[model samples]
Target: MSILESLELALKNIVSSKTRTVLTMLGIIIGVAAVIVIVGLGNGLEQYVTDSFSDMGTNTLTVTVMSRGSTRTLSVDEMYEIVDENSQYLDLCSPTVTMPGYVKIGSETITSTSVQGVSEDYFSISGDTVASGRGLQYSDMAARGKVCVIGAYLNLAYYGGNAVGQTLRVGGQSLTIVGVLAQTDEDLEEGGSDDCIYLPYTTASRLIGDVSSYIITMQSEDYIDESVAVLESALYEVFASDDYYTVTSMSEMLETMTSMINILVGVLAGIAAISLVVGGIGIMNIMLVSVTERTREIGIRKSLGAKERYIMQQFVIEAACTSALGGIIGILLGDGLSIAASTVVTRLMEETLTVAPTLSAVALAFGISVGIGILFGYLPAKKAAGLNPIDALHYD
Candidate 1:
């Protein structure tokens, strides 16, 4: 018989002991499944992080004014200098000033709505557009614009509905609400909506006692690195001290998330490796027992003139075939389980399960598991091959 045919016969013999074969395969099954699931989770975390950052929107950066003595060390002039120097370096720029107040209209009053004074270009930088009413115009901000933009939460809170074209009090000063912001969850979570109110920069300065707080945001598309460097240089020249006020690059969030993903992958791989080793040991134990049981058969074949090398090859092939079969099934099971788990997680959280184990992961896991089986199975095969025909055949 051809060597392959002999191996196939050995596999058939193994299959005759169906329960034993299945029990043996179980180790490989568990090992492969663990690898796939852990690897899949690692991939999932990476995608989830990326999605969160993308939702934050395009090349965005924030500059904040930090001051020790509350006499307003950083003025609007500094904001102008930063913006003017770096406007070409970015897509959009804005300054943010915040105040806390109640919005009062006749008998209706909404408390704890955040009020913000932002440049007219804040909407463009934030990728937000008004759902209704007009946003802050350049003309409006220049006149210390009393005109304002309202977020959806404001509509729900003060107006009990749409408050477009309605008048609200800022520091008890009447200001016309010119626009309502679009209802995007991200926008609301951000300072623009459910959490806060928005007003033109000039009007906010008028309402709050002339304190311009922070140089907030700039946006860009390409060459973000170059833009960040230039902006940093310009801001340094303006502030001259890192402690005075700081500019934070949006890329920090991305970098942190990516680092977290790499760490997770490493941790998962380590955990999965333990399971694989356990599986390998199980295979070895089973093969050793099989060799012991087949000792008499090895002696009988040897007595009939089978060479030691042939006997060794036969047993080794048997062990390898057993492992290869187990690896195949285990791999399929692992991948299937990973996909199912991902689906369930998505349904429960209402978030996409964005990571999938690449084909390389499956191939590598299965191949390694099979290789381990052969490696571990070698000792038992060797013991069977070295059996003395006389003693082995004479055994009961």
Candidate 2:
């Protein structure tokens, strides 16, 4: 028989045993679906984390005291020490002392706001565009000015666009709204929107009553390794020891996170891989039953001069058909679940995440399913083909 004829007959036999065929296919369908969902979710989470860092600006580097340095003492002078030495490689740097307090303007008062003291470079350091008011300037810090920049969240919260150029008291110190940073951050987790409210470092230091301790933001233009090296070398020279300061870079953090997620995705998919094996086993069992039931058919075909190879080929095709159908269904369902999962994860993170089914992934799943069917089904089919035709025909 031709390959086409063998294929047509194989499918007919499968349909004739509809319940058994479907039950055998269940394992493949579940395995494929699980693999797709697990892998897609892993890839999506990596993308979400990377995008959140990108949203913070790829060139950005945040500086802070390390957790291990918790017992160590640091001063504002040390912040200047890191910058004064590293200033050549750095595009810009600014120090911040966060003080969360209430803001009051006339009859309006809003609490839970994160108040910060930064300088002229902080706005551009963060790519925050002024939608309504102006950001702090050199003279603002020099003259010990109380001028401030507010994010749109605070603008809409305590006052409307009406807050522009209006005076608000933070911690009982008066500040004039000079500029408003663009409200590009989409997070709504309580004070997440209130990412910053800029006052001159001088003003903030005095208001917070602690100029010595703070967060510093920096910008770097080179590769992550180079940037970290340059920043560390300069900071070490400034501190004369590693005991007092810590540095964290966006590229470094994002790269580490991406690698970790990839490994996790692989491990998760590997666990799901056991299901593929189980599905392949199901296919083999069903194929063996098919061969037994069709013993007479096999003998009649052999008597009619059909080759053993042809008979084996027919059973293999039946195995592949079951897997192919399951694979198609699984891809559809898995893609939908992955999209929803990524969406929810991104929302929880306050950042936009991209999750799309990749062509490589689709091809891999389909290819593997079909390959499993063939590999497992081949053994049973070979036994059926080598059957003693005379006995098959004479029996039952």
Candidate 3:
């Protein structure tokens, strides 16, 4: 018989026993859906991580100095000098001083605001743009000016979006807001990315303590390794030991996070694929039962000069058709679940992460399902083909 005739026969058989066919395909359906959803979640997570790292400037490096009881210390000026000397690799440098205290804006005392002391170049390095007024300048840092820049949340919440020239108190020190940053996040809520304060490192040092952490940007991310090496060598010379100082690259961290996500997705997908095997076995079992039930038909066809190959072909086609149908249903179900998952995650986590299954994943899932059907169907098909016509004819 032709392949099309075999397929038609397979469909008729599947339709005639709808409940049994569905039961046999259940494993394939569940396995395909599970793998697709897991992979989609992984993709969304990786994108989220990449975006977060990008906001922090993936080309930048964060350095922390411990000094470790050593008398030698690196000053902000020395650090700038090192960057200036290695101008080819390093671009901008900023001393970061994290201040601890509640911010008092008028009568309101906000405890969630992040107040930091940074240089004029800090805004450039961090990719933060000033939306109103002017940013911190070299003159402000030189004279330890009390001027500061505010994020969008603080600007709109307290100053009604006119934060420039307004004053807020941090640790009892009044700082005039010189600029308002452009909104970085979609929603401006309290304690979010848009709620922040930035002042000159010199003024912050005077109020708090000396700066021990610095953020430096590379001229190009392509030369990250070289930039890190140069910066590390300079820091090593200052501390006289690697233990006294540490440098961390944001790009490297991003890569590590992506790799971890891929590995996790792979493992979860592999585990979910086990169901496909179970489903294949189910199909094989059902096909064997089918062959037994149709023994009289097989015997009559064989007695009428039907070939063994034709008998085997019909059974194999039936199994493949069943699996292919299940795979199509699984693809539809997986897509629906992915969309639902995206919405649920967004509402629960308060973040917009899209769960999108790739075309390759769907195609691969379908291919594997069909392949499994053929593989498992072969033994049953062989047994049916090898049945003795005389015995089958008289048995039932």
Clashing pairs in 2: 133-179, 133-180, 134-178, 134-179
* TM-score between model 3 and native: 0.95
Residue-pair clashes per prediction, in order, are 2, 4, 0
In candidate 2, stretches whose alpha carbon ends up further than 4 angstroms from where it belongs are 65-88, 100-111, 185-190, 194-196, 209-220, 336-354
lDDT per residue (tens digit) for residues 66-91 in model 2: 43343444565665666666665555
CA lDDT, candidate 2, residue 20:
84
Tens-digit lDDT string for candidate 1 (312-383): 777777777777887788778878888888888888876777447778888888888778877887888788
TM for every model, in the order presented, reads: 0.83, 0.86, 0.95
The Cα error of candidate 2 at residue 320, in Å, is 1.8
lDDT of each: 0.74, 0.75, 0.93
Cα misplacement distance, residue 118 of candidate 1 (Å): 2.4
- How far in Å is the alpha carbon of 206 misplaced in model 3? 2.2
lDDT of 2 at 115: 80
| Over 4 Å off, model 3 | none
Query: What lDDT score is found at residue 59 in candidate 2?
Result: 74
Worst 10 residues of 3 by lDDT: 66-75
